[model samples]
Target chain A: MSHQFYSIECIIPPHIQNNIAEKGTPEQRKKVMGSISQSAAIRAQRVLLTETKALVEPVTVGGKQRNIFNLNFGSNLPGILARSEGAPPTGDPAVDEAYEGAGATYDLYQQEYQRESIDGKGMRLDSTVHYMKGYDNAFWNGRQMVYGDGDEDLPEPQRIFNRFTIALDIIGHELTHGVTQFEAGLVYRDQSGALNESFSDVFGSLVKQRQRNQTAAEADWIIGEGLLSPNINGIGIRSMKAPGTAYNDPLLGKDPQPAHMSDYKTIDYDNGGVHINSGIPNHAFYATAMEMGGYAWQKAGQIWYVTLRDRLTSTSVFADAAQQTYLVAGNLFGGGSLEQQAVRAGWQAVGIQIDAGDSGGNGGGTGGDTGSGGGTTSPGCSTALVQLLDNVKALIENRSR
Target chain B: MKISYRRTGGFAGMLISHSFDTDTLPKTDAEELVKLVSAADFFALPSKITATGADQFQYTLTVETAEQQHTLEVGETSAPENLRPLLEKLRLLARGKPDL
Candidate 1:
């Protein structure tokens, strides 16, 4: 707990490095350059630290009463060293970052949720630094989380505007997986899987925001923006502020995530494209929060947390999830509360329904859903759409790692 | 002893390989290991994903060093303690695909 966590960062995929290398703006270039330098320094430092020996002591300061360490156990990667809890980071920035990220995630949950651990069961949090030497990805592998140094394989990776580095959002995103496993345990495929992912995104972003001590309004609302290696012509991991706006570089192609159900791409990866299709719900939360302004955690965070706890199930579909939130809004906030109305309206904006017909009004599901159905000419359509979009974004961002 | 393994293409196009020396394994033990590893389904590669398979895993592996046999399975688990989970993750360069 005493070791400074930010001293290290995970390996950045070469592709992410390439993306940052191509940015037109000098500031962006500088930021990427600095991040690269810092990340490399941390990595080098970790190597030296690993060879040295130091005892890690307990930290009981600030709002953190519990003792949690940078706790990712490398997913048994070859030649990787599994770090013990509270162990001093081996002067490696990447290792330090992983440890720090894990500590931050653990603290976020312990401080905010009153949860004991990722399992709410005091599960030991273990992490490995210098994973894969130069891996480019990170994820929560059911038992534990592991990080990669870089994604050396993908063509779009190295030369892209944004490169891979284990940033806060990615860390936050993976940690939320444990929360999801305990709570709704959303199936890892299709709509449920997407919901699972959405929750992580929500809390993941919140973790970063909380760490910076930034109010919801003051937050950047972009996840993983600073995490990528400076090479891609894009933003961060995924844009919650502007769902599809995270990346627009030619090499990486579009973000591939659609903001609405009408545009949901039903792929087979991550269980019916859970990861890819998640953009729909992720956007919905963003839209909801923007509509309901102010510090999202106060009103919007509470509402989403309640719904996730009480209203959501492992197999809930988007429409079902929408309706559940709508129902929760009325029950928790009172009948016809602004929360309920907003929740219902939010779903509609995303081609979903909260108890009634399709988002296309009465057109029904599987019908080329869009605003072509017409709302009988109402001036509120655009405004409502924008608000809902923002609300969805906020909700999802709150749940990020 | 010869075992067959076909790991999904990784970021490096390199195969995740493991070798060990086991002279104590009985013939049935070896058969069981192969059955167990292949049945572990650690990778969970979805059919539609041409780029990469599902990284989530609960995998196991039983490589007979003396026999030169290896087995790997992705997705679905036949046993909770089976080696599939750990082996599956080891194959993934700590890059967070799925858990073991």
Candidate 2:
């Protein structure tokens, strides 16, 4: 049989894009130049290897999902082993990872939420494994997911045993992108994008916690805990339980996620660093899990999942998501259920409160302007928030008027 | 000379910069094809076949993350015309902005 294959690269890694985007000095520009140089050398070498490989025929009768090419995970560049139907990973570590990851995601959706494939229409799952030479990341594009073998400086082979590279949680985290895409399609910009990322982390962590038989209290609630490459900075890429504490590395700097709304970063990049500012809702979920004191999947995951599916808008923002989840929690478990209360407390912990109007509390948008009950974290917002509040007020008034 | 194609900078995933080190005719042809297809991502001047080492003409392409500004290098011992399909894939990836 012949094989058809394709390669996908990761989101901008720590070095090139982050550096160039953040800095404006000559020295920083030099570093960008150097990265460009190194990239050129690697690409040249990569082209040579792929050139010699013969075209691989597809094993499946129908084309591989959306296209006619088959993508199999392997060490060979541009190696196409088989198509998307029942394509078990064939002893290739990368393939195995992709296969297993897909399985876990599929299982999670079916078992937990009863959702269909990425599009809720049994869309054939497609993935490319062993994507690039020493590439150090994995990400889901709009259509499919791609994995990198990682670089020598990072984790070689990018392999994880119990925790390192092979963590099922991370797999779930990446795959949730598909779920988000199909559902809320949260715009990846400003607060909305951050909310989108938060939803992914919340659900991603729950998928792992539920699978591993860990209670919400017991789970670490970190996105890529053990998968952090040995030489990199920080413990993982992100932490739901503790936002900014994920890492403190020299080269990669630190995990910059702020857990509270007051500290929210309004700067718009990486679609508002959806991954970075996601820490806010992540913390909200963590707090909800803590207050609920049970398996997170039972209450917390269900709440986020349902809201993600039903309540949240495609362009939902952090506050919008928070408000929607609060309403959903009440609907799922009743207004006075512990689930709803925990939802309120959770959002409050992140310096977000269900509007008195939304909650049917004291009304007049009054009572407590109080942000948090008792948490070390504070919202990252500022006097600018007042302006935002004014804008929101005008919006409400305009709509009402 | 051996050659391959590497791609990088799309979504929130791995960075790809692939190549095969070799001195072969088909390999060189693959590189040439890729260059021809990737007109949008190239610099000025036609790719010159320079014998950098051995009897191989190095065809180089640099792709930076459109959103992240990360750069990845992909090249081959062949000319760019031989690597059309691979180059097309990279072009598609760099075209749109990823949500996260």
Candidate 3:
């Protein structure tokens, strides 16, 4: 198995696609199936991308540079440049939304976390709208953002999916995947993969919250707020406040997310339930934000940002993330403070016990397998085994020295 | 003789299945399917596909003839190129979509 270098992060999960294929009309089925194939083909392209070294110059403008493209129902990427920085809106909903959403995300990272951009180096934000004919999904293809216009051929009741660019949080969610790629570089598989997904959701919520200036209490923690069609029995794709309750429809099926570690899925599919089990950490973040009482991005988001940017390695597990955030929260806001306590409680809410006293040996230390690997976290050898081996190796090397 | 195919798992996690009885199918299509199945050596295909990530569809083909019945499973990304036409036809039939 080769090292899994990149990931295709989509707003709609696979289970939802499967549900549509089974229950949707013949036209809907064709659209959904085509989306599945398109996404698969993009994943295949991602593998090829890793093989080549593409040079991307860091943007050093006033802040961020946003470039929007229109696929015009075609497959080619970054198709036609619809808008760019300092340009007026083209009166197109998708283009305007993508531009504003990218700007909002940049502002959140810029003003809150002081992140230059998704890469912390002012990387130009590139997006493509109307990716394909009757496409049902939007995704970050480990490179640029792509959105679909949503299926228009289905009947009103069967029209359960809206345009991909309809939701601001969904845009934030997709862009955060790019942030994860640059920072944690979380291998998109297994527990670490879930962490990759959870981080994206966490920050995605933050971007939306900061944009609306909504507090944790005031904000609706739904990830894809307006992305779902009105005819569906669902509110959104995934709800951070209530994981499994996000959607329950005859066509979409029930949301399969588990908010606690005990209920975590251990399936071989979906890269070990990367998108499904993310509910655990997502709830943890939501809890932490609620406990902090105010804007979530202020304290809770900061801790997670610091953890993602500095503390987490590519192979860090849920426990490692929980522990690292606990340590970082204390460091950011004095030990035993309300912020620190909230961080500790957050992990505990998700069945991950992070000892308050455990400062994690060395602060911000690279634990276990550092960069991307074969996308699999070894069985039974989790954060504990990683720490143990590190200690053993340290002892042997010190003795020889 | 009966030929059945089912496709499950994708971004939406949908399952679509259809069966074609040799006696019920058009003579030309049935002959083509048999030739395709035999020439493609459906039985030799792998049982399960290793998915690279999310949104992958899994295809299961079941063929029953006078001698025996056989089942073959392949993933969307891992399936051999030879099986494309057969899988495409099966998906269309399963969804009640026009194959022509």
Candidate 4:
């Protein structure tokens, strides 16, 4: 057994060992650990050699690796590998589109946000296209992307949708759901679900904008642009800039998204209106980006990304999103800076008021214009300290109540 | 026997519905529908089956017989294996309808 353990180190490559460490069963992982410990000096030398090689050669580590599959109009996932990373186009529109879409989505997160991939650990992106005949939807499925061909089987005059992979933002949107799953794990119901949907739309639109080199003002802010069929009286599935106006066709009914909290729909279906109410926060993001007046990804996108990655929880509501984005903007820029003010105005435009108490104690208050910049006077207290004091005060108030 | 199905909350956020009475169909089709419903043990299913994921479809299915009627709401991920064939049949039937 001791000889076998030493032999294991010689046989298995370091990359395979890393993979086993991450995904192997507990017993297997323990065995791998023992082998690693027994061969520390050899492993160190190997690591140094690998690092030296990497320094001299171009590295693909933490880079995008996409796998596109053809479902062949079947329901089974990843039915057949149509394209792999760095592969040439297959001439099949669905396969090629899925391939390109995944790459573009990967680029958005990797280039703009410094996120390695959907899981923030260079997880390989897998997408299956042509899922089920005339299937009119796409989804993240908690693991990989699944896209339907839409009403392609229907007669041209009656078709209501194009292929699910037609829109780059839709691909970005579904991929961002994977990001949200790895991050906040927002429950797929009620307000948290709406926030989940909103985050997808926010990042999805940003992906398209960055790819197009569009400024905040130049971008259309549509979630599923060009996805609807030509006969349909719709530009897209939903509009972040103008939520309820995305579509209004006799066949598809109307887009029911509301732009403000005052108009929030309390419906029984659609998971407490997750898709519907997402418009509020979507518009809020649009407003924030518009106010910031540059590439939306620069400030507005960073604030939302940090908030989603750090501050928001599974059960966070609209108010929590507003508050956290404001705090994150303040933290990233400066307290009461233009970016923070833009976030505040964005949420305010959507009828969600960030609690003044939360921002008052941001502590890095460079702007003396804010009336409640009391935390700025206390230079000894850090922002975290001020936040702690606020939490304590809130706890006392809740207890008394 | 009467059956109705509504699907909501996909990535596109579109709503689709289809309803039909077995009596209106040919005898063979009606019998097949009855067989599918019976095979699914529709009445035995819980009123709601919950699932967690983003942008998956939610289905509302109602079946009516001479004596009783039952409605079940299920998410796509949580939909039981037995229930899927019936859902698939209904989804195919719903295609090409004006409201789809």
Candidate 5:
């Protein structure tokens, strides 16, 4: 909790936002800028809040606790309480969708990974819908998720984005950011940053696939499906099976994700291509899952979860992640087993080589040998979020002064 | 004085840029922009902003004044409050330039 953890995983990348700003009509440009400004403002506020000691304590809540908030087109965090856990659907599409999406994500981590909630300690899941006027993005702003209406006010054909909460994978994707905050705490820049993004995409897709009961072969492997407005000439934002093939619209441009390290982008934009280069490891996970030939969440997801929770450090790069997952796989499925081989193949496909000698407890240099169990029980999380709610209230009060 | 702003990074890996000489802008607006830029103290800002993994925009601003030339890379969220108007003006002026 003492370590500052803040990241915003926007469903729409900033390049797309910049493109829309340039290519869209006056109104569309305003909407996209609104989204960008909102994001910037939230980040600025988050940096200030995280520096305060009062906001960094963690609180444990038993079972699934979700709170869906209604922003009503105003810029506010955790807006009016629309619904709480076990509440009846209010017939409000945004509220209901947010509620249901959070539930499904919670179920996935709890049922599949045996973790309680995003923090593995039953941390409360909070979301805000209808954030700001004409906002066009959804993001996990460190503490909670906030979604926009996706330019709904515009007429058909002109609208470029659907409601942020419409796609369940988007919800799963944002929530996984929270889990990453609690777990690996990966430094959100360069290669480490991409791994953080890939983990979210990997689990986000699994949440959608598992909900549909689709096998690895049956899954589409696309993140943010149904997120773009109908007029856009793209299926989704990013494709896992095929990284750069997701979208190619006149305004949004082509997806620039690289499936291999050779094509990795090293620029400082998008936090060293966190969203772009994630395609490398994302493809790795898909390949590993397909090779195993069953439910991806079963073995593939388990290997990733263990690697992320127990092995990864804040500075882990792609090679570090590959090594940890390979070692974790050997422990979970036995050394030289098919599952372990699949893990090796996954990293190799991404042009990252896992040293065969660095097997079973030899990797993840910060930790000790994980032994034959392969799975290490993640340690209990410290205080960070529960104290945030209290600190935010104080901040709001101070702002009014 | 000539000023240029280049924006890079984001989801799509695209770059957008625009530049204008102070001699071209309206006298009053140019004066306001010069004052704003001076107030922002761009040279004093940190080299990198916070390390959050959002699809943030990075702006490289180049100023060619009679005295000297200076360039700095700034995260979108890290720009000082006094510099907001200048950044917005640059982006507004950059509109309609065909994407490169």
Candidate 6:
């Protein structure tokens, strides 16, 4: 392979490589192991360069950097530069909100979890507001945050959503997608997709709680507080504390989230109910945070963050999440500690019983397959490697275009 | 002929949908809708198209005539170029209707 090929492949984290070895097809296994060996040879030199650079650079070299843009009711992204880091806030509420929300999210990850930024490599946060006239959505478009005006162009009584940037947790949730893209690279469908959404909600809620200086007990655990118009019969978009009760309106259908394994939805829409079944894991995290007490970003958030960055693979399922989080808590706070118990109890409340004797064994029987489960042990080319290859191909295709 | 459009899975997780029969619309409006459907070649598109991205919208568009009926589910990122105008028009129409 060319040097550039090796450089790109080498960036696949070691844990993901191990996952590929364990679960990948023979062809993929061979390819990844070859790259891993090549990576090992150059790893020392890279480390030396990193150390030397760290010594030469200031301690705040990776400080938070944010750029906010305005689409001005157009679909084109990063449309016009409205604000930049450390600059005076423009009076535009969407621009200022996006800027401040990014800062709050960055601070939660940096101060509490010691992460530099969404990518943990100090990637600059970029956001665009006013995506389209009366648009009612926000998303991380694989590169940066994009916010919609959320029916603001409509008359007051007809409007359902406020501006997308109205809620800090919503901003955190979108940015966390970038973190997941860089970390687990979780497949965006089925059980893995639900896990992906759940992690975002977890950290998103933590960002809000930390911003308001509220303890886990005091926080509302709402994902998009104040994002709904007063005429809408809903408190927010999704409630972590109570998944299905966030909204019930004549205009917007009832929230479809289910709070337990027994109620796991198996619909065809929403990418196999990514937003619906997520309620199970969302409630689990809420339960864990409440059990741990104090600031959620401290203990519960730490356990979940370490699990996301280190333990999870692209195809990991809810059972894998249950098992890995339990193991991670034990590892962090000692076996049989209160923190470990809290983790176990959290999953238990959501109908997933973590096997105390499993000890993070290879696979199977951490908990019963809760409908479309067992992604980690499935035999095939590793989904993570396949996703990586697909991403590279898409990048090439886009560049060629 | 009847056409129905439903959108779901945005950040808000709200579901909005609308359906209309050609007979119920004004003649001009019905002809315009027919032109959009044909211009987009809606029947020829795949039944499902997905793209990687979180919180993007998912749309389901269904068209029915005396001869056949077709439905397509697509994520915003993977939506075909020709289908964009049809999707936008349907979205606006759906927004005008009461929640389904």
Q: Which candidate is the best by DockQ?
A: 6
| Candidate achieving the largest lDDT | 6
Which residue pairs collide, candidate 5? A56-A384, A57-A383, A57-A384, A58-A383, A58-A384, A269-B9
Writing each residue's lDDT as its tens digit, candidate 3 over A1-401 gives 11211111111112223223444677876576444433333333332342232235334354789999998876656699999998998999999999999998888889888988766667789989987655556667666677877665456665667787888887887888888777656777777878888887898889888888999999999977877687667788788999888877666677788999889988755557777888999999999999899999999999999888755655667876887787667556644567877888888888888755433222222221121222322232233334434554664575579
Tens-digit lDDT track of model 6 for A1-401: 13222223323333234344545777876576445433332333333444444344322336899999998987766699999999998999999999999999999999888999877778789899998777888998777899998888788987877998999999999999988877777777888889989998999888889989999999999989899899888999899999999988877778889999999988877778888899999999999888999988999999999989866777777877887788677556654667878999999999999867522222222321211132322223244345555655664575579
Task: Encode model 4's per-residue lDDT on A1-401: one tens digit a residue.
Answer: 23222222222122223222434577776575444332333333333443343344222346888889898887767689989999999999888888888888888788878998877777778889998777888988767889998888888888888998989998889999988877766778888889999999999888899989999999999888888888999999999999999998877778889999999999877888899999999999999999999999889999999878755656667876887788677666765788888999999999988754434223345452242333322222233334434554664575579
> Which model is ahead, 4 or 6, in terms of TM-score?
4
Candidate 5: list runs displaced more than 4 Å. A1-59, A361-401, B1-100
Question: Model 4 chain A — which ten-residue stretch has the worst lDDT?
Answer: A7-16
Per-residue lDDT of A1-401 in model 5, one digit per residue for the tens?
21112111111112223222443677876576445433333333544543341236344577999899998876546689999999999999989989999999999999888999877667789889997655556777667888878767667767777887888888898899888877667767777788888998999899999999999999999988887887888888899999999988776678888998899887755667788889999999999999999999999999999877766655667776787788678666655668888999988988988766534532222221323223321121112232334455666787779
The worst-scoring run of ten residues by lDDT in candidate 6 chain A lies at: A363-372
Error of 1 at A100 (Å): 2.8
Residue-wise C-alpha lDDT for candidate 1, range A279-381, written one tens digit per residue: 7887777677766666665556666766665445455567556765654454445445566567777667788865422122212222222223323223433
> Which residues of candidate 2, in runs, are more than 4 Å off?
A1-79, A82-89, A152-165, A359-401, B1-100
Candidate 6: where are CA atoms >4 Å away? A1-62, A358-401, B26-35, B38-48, B64-71, B80-82, B96-100
Q: DockQ for all models, in order?
A: 0.05, 0.05, 0.06, 0.43, 0.11, 0.45
- Interface RMSD of each candidate, angstroms, one decimal: 9.9, 14.9, 6.7, 2.3, 4.2, 2.0
Residue A144, candidate 3: Cα error in Å is 0.8
Clashes of 5: 6
The Cα error of candidate 1 at residue A51, in Å, is 40
Give lDDT: candidate 5, residue A341.
82
lDDT of 3 at A9: 18
What residue runs in model 1 are displaced by over 4 Å at the alpha carbon?
Answer: A1-90, A151-165, A356-401, B1-100
lDDT of each: 0.50, 0.53, 0.69, 0.77, 0.72, 0.78
| Interface RMSD after interface superposition, model 1 | 9.9
- DockQ, candidate 5, vs. native dimer: 0.11
* lDDT (tens digit, per residue) of candidate 2 on A166-205: 5566667656776776665565566666776677677677
Candidate 2 lDDT at A237 equals 69
* Angstrom error at residue A175, model 5: 0.9
